[model samples]
Target: MKAFIVAVVAAIGLAVAAMYALTSNQRFAYQAFATTGARVSEPGTNLVGEKWTGDPNTNDKSESAHGKATGEPSHPKRS
Candidate 1:
């Protein structure tokens, strides 16, 4: 029982250490947002908490076709 407890504690400690090491780097711990304004789940809210207008499905097909015709990569608005 004592051995099992020690093993579990060691595992938890190692996990915590690994997490700390991974997040300690500036690259990993990047703060992209300046303020915590609104939730993205709310209506009209984008990823950056900015007001998003227009329908997401309404992508301009003409622009994509034009790009393709010009030998450029056709960037579709869909994810």
Candidate 2:
């Protein structure tokens, strides 16, 4: 039982030491953080707090795409 406890403690210590060594370098640590941060989450709000943004979308589908050509025209058309 005592040997088992010592082994467990040694493993935890070794793991911590490994982590510290990996993160001790400033350049490598920051590069790892930046690359990891971009891949880990969606591009959403990460701020501390938010206020009432208000209902900005009071009007919906009110704009029209009238006379919009779908395809490229062969002749040069005047705008």
Which candidate number would show the highest lDDT if scored against the true structure? Answer: 1
Q: Which pairs in model 2 have colliding backbones?
A: none
Estimate the lDDT of model 1. 0.40
Best by TM-score: 1
Query: What is the lDDT for 20 in model 1?
Result: 90
Instruction: Give me the runs in candidate 1 sitting further than 4 Å from their true place.
Output: 26-79
TM-score of each: 0.36, 0.34
lDDT of 2 by residue, 1-79 (tens): 9999999999999999999998565332222343532422111111221111333232222244222222332342399
